[model samples]
Target: MASGFCEDCSRLLDEFCVYLRKVCREFEQKIRDVFRELSQCTCFRIAPESSFLRRRRRRRTQELLSLHLLCDDETQLLNQESLHALSRLASSEDTDLQTTAAMFYLHVSHHLKSSLPDAFMEPVMALLLSTDLDVQKTISLSLVNLLAKNNVCKELVIEMGMLVPILELFQSGDAAAQCHSCACVTLLASSESKSEAIMVDGIMPLLALAKSYEPQVQQNATWALLHLTQSDWSTRILCEVGAIPVLVLLLQSSDSQVQFYSCTALCNIAAVREHHPKLLSMGGHFLLKSLLTLVSSSVQKNSTQACRCLQTLSRNVLIQEQLMELDCLVPLKALLKNSSPVRRESAITLLSALSAHPPNNDVLVSEGLLEEIGQLLHHQTSVIITHSCKIITDLCGSSMGQQAVMDSLCVSGLLGALLSPSVSDETSLHVTSCLYHLVTWDPLKSNLSVTITSEQVSRLVRLSGLIQNPQLSYNSAAIISTLAMTEEMAQLLRPHYITMLEYLLVFLKKKDVKLQQLGILTVFNLKKDGGFSSLLAGSELEAQLWKVHAQTEETRRLLQMITPLSPSPVDP
Candidate 1:
């Protein structure tokens, strides 16, 4: 039996390639007739000998399929061949081929849409509207991918009014169709500006679907919201349609992924300046309180959303005050003390935004929050310290905050942080800036005794000790200059002036022009208390000053041409 079946299969294989490559109308009809006959017999349950022939027949069919694809010259011809194959499988009284043909239609239709004329789109759109839910969802999924590739097809799809079918798919009782609908919307939402149209198309009707009991469908819906809510208009639309309530409902989902993105979606929508008030109107504060709970619970995802939500909350002064009223500061301040550096940075950020309000600063100060910020001045990362310094400056801008910060016992820690050797040059700048703000405070001057010690003074002097590191020297000079303006600070730093002078003079010995120039500036500043003459008293310092003054003048002359041309003399 096997031998006989093999011979018959060999005879059938001989014309397989020719049949597949045939282009004339009769050739296609013959191939369809052969496919119909082959689809009838169940070859799998036959005897082993006959099954061998069936396997050979299957191989020949696949080869013929491959040949048809290769022989087609243009995309339209290929699409027609695909349509023929689909027709055979769709109409033939064979289940397997029907399945195979459905899949074949999908594969070929995808390719044809790219290279074929715009005319082929109607067929693909027709597939999306099929009564067969599986077929509709599958092909609709593919159409979205094709249309999203370019604005031309995207516009065509829109003009074709096919989005309504896709939107209907979103509402389908079939979970598979619903998932594809969400996917389709995401593809359509790739353009940021057009997102508003998706909202106007009744997207809020699907919010409940996003919060559905089925996890897979809900995930897709949430993702769709993520993309749609990227636009401010969609956020407004969602809020107008009360989508926030559904989103907030999803926040309590047992699935962390759902809850995570749901909160993120909320944050994104809430971030819009216009929509922020709407969020507050729609219980935005409750959402924020939920975020605060997440932060306190050590759920990292929740903490991140909470931080961003706090930043969004910064846009509303009323909410900002409300945050204080809810005592939102406690968890955020707790984050500052957190072991995670990121959480601490977030805490600092919220505090900075919260402190921007004058009333909130009092709350922060009254709560002893200045010390928390002061501790951050010496953080391992310069960025944290930089922000911490800005916070310090803001806090010190108010008299109450200044007094609270000054009394925090971290003042010396802050000053020592400036002199700390391992921090980045940027950090040194921030530290000096904080000191600048601290000393420049009009009210703090009277209370500013020599709270900074001789040791801290010595540390500041050594900052300029390394002649090769000029940024350090500049920062130290800045710190000293600020201190010098205060009589008490100057008195404490006076004993160390000669050491600073020696460092500056040695720095001048180098051929660096800026160093030479700064040497003069240091001398000029030190002259405020006649300290220059004191350092120059040995005649050695005097000789060095004269040498630097000349070298400085020569360097200035060399740079004169590179300087901007002077404005033409005014006609007097």
Candidate 2:
């Protein structure tokens, strides 16, 4: 059966080119027949209104049946010619016939959702150079749908050969051709090697077309540039082509789409860390405000791309300063309220960048950004909670931001997250670092025990005792010392004195003397309270352990300070 089938296919292959031309002519004839029928129906309705309703549904059915029959005929032709025959006919030397064949197949592919051969990609790509405006329009319009719908086609075209031929479409004078060809190269450039091929040679054309008089061509070209500007080499080549200024100017396009494309493209280039100097030299920082516009966009992808762009841009110290100069801190913080996870994630990441910069904290603290970030502490997504913890921890780098975070986040946010039963080890570390910084900076100035419950206090003391997580344990151990500065603060930790002391002893027993100093100090603060100290007042084991670890000057000073009833430890 296979041999017979191959033999018949070989016979059909000999005449498939003629068969394709016939199919094209028949398809065009069917279209003209429809126009003739529509003309007749219009005259019939004008001359006699009685026949309008009678003929309308019948004509519509016949038109659909005719199109369906053409599709059935094409499917039969595909079966007869076999897939291999498509390659021969698609590469035919007769350009006009090839164009018509492309038209017929494009129409058939549209009408029938599947079973269209991908072997025709080369013909459509080659037709890109046709000087005929109508041919260019036909191929450009058809190419976008074919490429968009088929991943198999994308893979096939990626292997076909050099993308240098596609460059002509970028410079093609016709607007529709220019618009769709821009779209074509955009889709084609999604392939990594092909992207390099296009970026290396076609970057100039893509950039020039990005400034087109036509909005669609500009949008399409900008979208193409976004795909091509991904790799380090492409980004460098794109910078060499002066895309930064065009992108900065295109950010203000009246068309929102063009603006978004330019934002994504420019951001992709800016994501390369080494390219930062080039971007700034070309005045690319001017794109930040427009990028902010996209961050606030109602479209999720636009918002996501914009937030990510700013996230990378903010990494540069100069751009971080530029972001503050543009007054971007408040608007950036507004994205925390967004419902989309992706957009919020990117926004949170950007805030993490801003929050770490000391100068950004001036604006952030003034804008009350801490309060907004503090609210997401118990968010259902653990990653957001983790990143939020990081943001607050970074914000704690400065005294003013630290105070603002403590004022807004201490009771309402970080403590609650730290006290949660399911909080991960990583999140616990950052959250405790925030508390550690808060108390270390202005322990006595701010009252942490105001609204905090005994349970939350117990959780912190217990976290300090954790043996498995040393960093969290040590930071929590350090936090317990300053948190005990006030009588009321010491009183809150009074209930968990046993757990608190266990961790502090764990700190003292270790070889690291700084931790020993911190441990003894924390014990001194907790031991000074009568109620807290009285729990271990009669316990000689505590004193003996202290004596054993007091070999260092710091530990002895701590011991002496607490001498008359053991009242204090050495403080930093």
Candidate 3:
């Protein structure tokens, strides 16, 4: 009885194994049949009969629902049996089945903590080469989802040689397909190692699509190009491939997103100085106009970037002239008052560039830029103060600019910055230089006594003692010389005269030709007031001047006019 029971149990176990295998096979066959039927039924081309159309629509919906339900079961979804069935569907001749299968694969892959098996990459990439527009679109999107944030999957796709085919879609695919393809390329490019491969395979095709009439296509293509431009070599290649004209034209796009990306690409290109001439020759004026408009309107996202582009373009002298001709300072002055510090900095920077050329200085003054820059002196940020000071300093090279700066009454702000311990040495130099121009403006000589104060004079004298900053020291000495032209002003500076003359002697003894000349000029002006002249004669500065007067032609020429009353040398 025991042997008989054992035989029956063994037989039953075999039968159960056979039953399970048969069930799995039957289930898979049913899934294939449904997929085949769905692929064969073209809902778009269905018969016009109301009843027939309704039935077909219901059937398609039910089939899709059943597939979704199957996918919803996580336990069965990752099973080897389900994966095999899905792979077959992904490669099916029916486009609908291929799309659904690709999407489901992506969904499953996304949920898994570990990467999908490398074996699965082939069928997914195979589907990407599908001639069916719907299949290509779905597969491209699924690939993007599958490969996102997953370096292993990206490598697998590249290893399978899918990059070129994927890029090819951007050339011939419909708008949606092109957009999706561009997105995939962008994702792949995010991997620093993979960017070169994408560039090698897709750059030209991407450039072509940047000109597409579809705003979406234009945006995606330019975004991809923007990524490519991050590298120095890629930026050069982009310009070489004629991306500048295409990107510039896209600036006029009605879609702000398109405009933003295109502007970004052009901005990157503009950063490479070698590309500037070509960019300008290729209607960079339009680009300049577009950036100016964006900057003027103060579109927050693009405004700073636009300002940067303008700043870069402003390096070109011809471009500077053109920008002035276009009346760029009106918007730039408005930007200086903008609440955004970044916009303010960029605006000031562009203005500084424009102001570098002597001709633009008069325009800047005429446009009320001096007063606008003066307003920024109250800002708490150091860069704003520094750039504002720099613009004023550069503009002050001209008489009109100096008069404008004086007329605007910006000297007090500059004096404050010069005295502020928190200000950078560079900013101090700029402020001091600007003040030098203001105080030395011969036309404003009559107003010097009223325009400058005793406190400001004290600060100037102290600044002259800063041995580390020879330029600041020289500028400070020069301002004192101008103020000392009047007896009252000279008396106001008398308390600090000893320290001032000591610092001036240090500058006089320097090897730098400019500093020596400044020192001589300060002494010459100080002698204009008899009391200051007599004090200078008794001080040790007289010996230092005689010692330096023989060093260089500039010093000798400048000192020939100053006749110190005392001939005796002071003890060292």
Top-lDDT candidate index: 3
lDDT value, residue 455 of candidate 3: 80
Error of 1 at 9 (Å): 40
Considering only N, C-alpha and C atoms within 3 Å, which residue pairs clash in candidate 2?
562-566, 562-567
Tell me the lDDT of model 1 at 196: 57
**lDDT, candidate 2, 232-344, per-residue tens:** 65566677778888887887788878777778887888778887776677454557767877677777777777888888887888888888888776666667777666766
Taken over the whole model, the C-alpha lDDT of each candidate is 0.67, 0.67, 0.73
- Give the Å shift of residue 449 in candidate 1: 9.0
TM-score of each: 0.66, 0.61, 0.60
Error of 3 at 14 (Å): 44
Which pairs of residues clash in candidate 3, taking residues 3 or more apart in a chain or in different chains?
Answer: none
Q: Who wins the TM-score comparison?
A: 1
Q: Tens digit of lDDT per residue, candidate 3, span 1-572?
A: 35555777989988999999999999999999987777667864544468886896676566566568767776655556555656666666777767777777667656655666777676777688777777777777777776764724665565577777787777664777777776677666554454454455557788777878866666777777877666676676677767888788777777777778877877777777788888887554777787788786536777777888888877778888899888887788887778888878877777777777887887778778888777678673677776776677778777677778777757667766665668776777777776766665666544555677778788778878888877777777777666646667767877876777787778877788787788888778777767768788757889888677555557667777787645658842
Clashes of 1: 0
Candidate 1 lDDT over 1-572, as tens digits, reads: 35555776877876785676665668779899987676665763333357777895685487447535643544345455555555544554444444454454455545544443466566556656566777676677566556555513555565566667887786567777776777676665543445456545647556766867888767767777876777565566677777777777777777777777788888788677777765666454676677677667557766767687777777789888888888887888888888888788777777777777777777778788888776756565665676777777777767778787777644665676765667776677677667656766654543433567777777668776755666666666655654544565667667877787687777667776766666667666666776546666775556787887787689789879677856668852
Q: Which stretches of candidate 3 lie over 4 Å from their true place?
A: 1-161, 165-201, 204-220, 240-242, 254-257, 273-285, 375-402, 438-440, 445-449, 485-487, 501-572
